[model samples]
Target: MDSLSQPFTFSQRAQKLTGSAIREILKVTARPEIISFAGGLPTPAGFPVEEIHRAFDKVLSEQGRVALQYATTEGYLPLRQWLADQMTAEGDVVSPDEVLLVNGSQQALDMLGKLFIDEGSKVLVESPTYLGALQAFSLYEPSYTSIPTDEQGMLPEYVSSPEAAGARMLYALPNFQNPTGLRLALERRQELVERCAAARIPIIEDDPYGELRYAGERLPSLLSLGRKAGATVVRLGTFSKVLAPGLRLGYIVAPRAIIDKLVQVKQATDLHTSTLTQMAVYEVVRTGFLDKHLPTVRDLYQKQCGYMLDAMQQHFPASAKWTHPEGGMFIWVTLPEHIDATVLLQKAIDKLVAFVPGEPFYAGADVKRNTLRLSFATVPEEKIREGIAILGKLISEA
Candidate 1:
């Protein structure tokens, strides 16, 4: 009965990720007065609540008992077909057989980790990439390597080098990337796909924010370019940004072989995402609500982004450098070299503002203590101005 004799010990992977600084900091940011630019959450105001209710009722009325029941691991056939058609329209040669539905793109990342990443296997990521992706892949214990990126996106020269070939896989957010909101340039996309193909490296192209473009011309997705280059690419997307996040609907487009593996992993993970939710989302897509609804969300975020950028220009110190995103929820800021964003968080929180420090985005070294991510997705235009003003004051004082 001694405490030392207790039989419970967590797995090594769980232990390795137990004290994530981001998760620990999230606890401190929950206060109501704190204007948080840390999380990549969409504003609840834009969720099409009435349409979702209608879609739910229609699905139940139309499908009866089937909507509530369990579904195949491959997902609702019509939704898969619709996604295939969308990809086709986007210039990707996709088929229904190549798609597998998941709870979210987050789950798609996890499933990809489980399917391909062995413990200690080398994986490549953008220098300041999506933190959730870092967290997901970390659970699988991959040896992560940070690839250099600029405002344009990942450096093609580095990605195509033999050093990159040593990695088991590369994860990229080609369109409106998280944290930075940087879009990968079209020429670089073509170069990356062709180079990775030549090096025989598979890419997991996570593109949840592609449809959220507010300005500028659309660039072809890495998946499309990969297809042209005859490469093996797995593309993950979500309805979260477009339709609603609560629906928890996302899908993966990959080779039929990779889809098969991911389906097996998905079956083990959550028994095929919610069939009810999938059906509801499918009905909404069928009704053409998505096509009409998404533009409104885009316009709202665009105005909000513009408001934040304007405020930053007016309020921020001359030394501060920030990315001007064409679309998406985030803006990455680089402060003076003497400033540590993590240390500044305490002061920021005391001033009722919060932002994610840039250090956690890196794989190992603390190269960017001067950096931070600001989100414009959740806050209104007025609040964005207030938040940036607060952040500016803190930075100037620091």
Candidate 2:
């Protein structure tokens, strides 16, 4: 009788999707007075502004109409070829046909979900995985199986066993993973690929931070290692961290057959990423500018990370623990067992300091309440020290 009062019903898939916790917190952290460590944002200082400006001008001067026109769903040909060449240089052999450019890596996660997930299908993730991955995959509503992880990343034994037999795919960020900021040790990487191969499980190797290493030896990507051993792997990469997020450009490297399917879905989604932007990006990166620019970025990030860690050591309670990341933008903090990170966040915000509570980063029931994630890359050393000081006192008082 009260149809007027009823709202439009949402699809079951849409109903399960929730907003990103970090995104929502960004609104509060936006206050200039607040010293925030909540976001995994890259240092904007590293963005080659003058170079990008020149590239855009050059693109317009050279390929104006073609750059502005609709591009192939598979992506800009030269950029795709450039990616293939770069991969080959990195020792991950692949052809340009194997790479499909997407709007960004975020879209790749959604597309992978479209390709692999079904209702009640089993999906494996690290105990604390990327919140964005959870948000993207949750729309498909898979039964999540959180694999146990250590400071070295996911444990291979649990994921390779018969108990994980029903899982459709394993999603992992083996290099400087979000939230955790921990890398999968080099020794464990090959074992993981071998085990997942034996388990007959396909892998989605999400690697947006592999190139941002500050210290330690560079490791081989799972896509390269897995392919060498004849395992199926879908690799996702993005220029957001290395280049600029505003460009919204990324690519997927997979088998030609799988890439063909993804191209169809991507066409239905956005037709293609901005043709002008793709051409402009190619102009900027074509001359190996990133190779020269990235070292400065690494040095800057290393200095900032050291500053943040030093602050944490000076101020946190004895029971509090945190990860020491060799690279990337985040540091995962674990407070005393009795301390709830969400509650701690409320107190810190009042003191004009903010951090993302780690509970939202988990997919299953055994969520950790005492943990949180901190990003040091975007914050200056002075603010990082000040913010950590305030957050430290708040936790101790609590």
Candidate 3:
């Protein structure tokens, strides 16, 4: 590689953009020997490989030419319709036209940033929200306002903070949010919808983990409530969590007007999501495969989570605390007030265990350095026990 002897003049945005801390760490943890809980990767055991293969074969045989043809920016008709049906079943009463398929929910987030954000625009998010979202939205350089969050999730009440008071929109994860597996209470959802509607602030509800619940009652999405409240809601949904991430399929449901604008932007972004993949995913999931497959996924994750939690209880020092997620890939672990998780990650890597420190999830310096996120979906129960035991011992010694 030729090094630039001259100073390269990168764009201001390009200059500021940095890689995800977790992704950078993944370079080292990619070693097969590492017991990593760093990435929010799904369990390989839960992938519907056989069903996907069958679906792909069928699509290639029956709809060969069309499957390979260029698709509209709005995505495949049947797939969008299926997603609408799924949302309707979940009580959103959506139209297929309102759903625009994307490469993945991550791309949808990028599209949203392009659609709604401007330089210095106020964007609100949960204090310790999904790091990917923060990294995506940062490209547009929106001024972020971190909402106060707790075990109950991001608070929906009035914001007195002068910096965050006039935020244009709130980016929330009401169902098993990443980093912190805290699901927002139904009461909080209702309050948030009503308040945001009254304030004329739109909401972007990112819900990739909505259906993977293993315990407690499944609450209505913020979009569902926002619709009933007559507020603007744009919700991103993905098959990445439930199916395979490699499929790279997801969609966004919003008002048709917003969908129209996004469609134009998307046409300029990428012509469309892979038509073949969308067709195959629809074929696999159309006749109730996820309905059957998800229960097993839920059970596996629940068992793994239980093992980690039990191990944490037995091995972690009393000063450490962790959130109990009902359903999702992560558990948020907060260590003693004095310990920083970023530093602890080095020690964990030395012990052959890895996790994502929570600091990068925050937009700015108002971060909890003592917190970290652990993933249980991919690791086996025995590995979960061993890894958490090692992490707990380290925390105890720290």
At residue 195, give the lDDT of candidate 2: 85
| Candidate 2 residue lDDT tens string, 104-149 | 9999999999988998999999989999999888888899999989
Q: CA lDDT, every prediction?
A: 0.87, 0.91, 0.90
lDDT score at residue 298, model 2, on the 0-100 scale: 89
Error of 3 at 170 (Å): 0.9
lDDT of 1 by residue, 1-398 (tens): 66469698767776677565666776888877778887788878779999889989988898869988888999999999999998898789799999999989988988888988998898989888888898888898888777899989999788776656678889999888888899999889998998889877899999999988999998888888898898789999999988888788899999999998888888888778788888888888886787898899899889888998999999999999999998889899999999999899989888888888998888756368999988888887778899899999889998
Clashes in each model (backbone N, CA, C under 3 Å)?
A: 0, 0, 0
Model 1, stretches more than 4 Å misplaced? 1-7, 19-23
Ranking of candidates on lDDT, top first: 2, 3, 1
Cα error, candidate 3, residue 288 (Å): 1.3
Question: How well does each candidate superpose onto the true structure, as a TM-score?
Answer: 0.96, 0.97, 0.97
**Which pairs clash (backbone N, Cα, C closer than 3 Å) in model 2?**
none
Order the numbered candidates by TM-score, best leading.
Answer: 2, 3, 1
Better of 1 and 3 by lDDT: 3
How does residue 359 of candidate 1 score in lDDT?
A: 87
Clashing pairs in 3: none
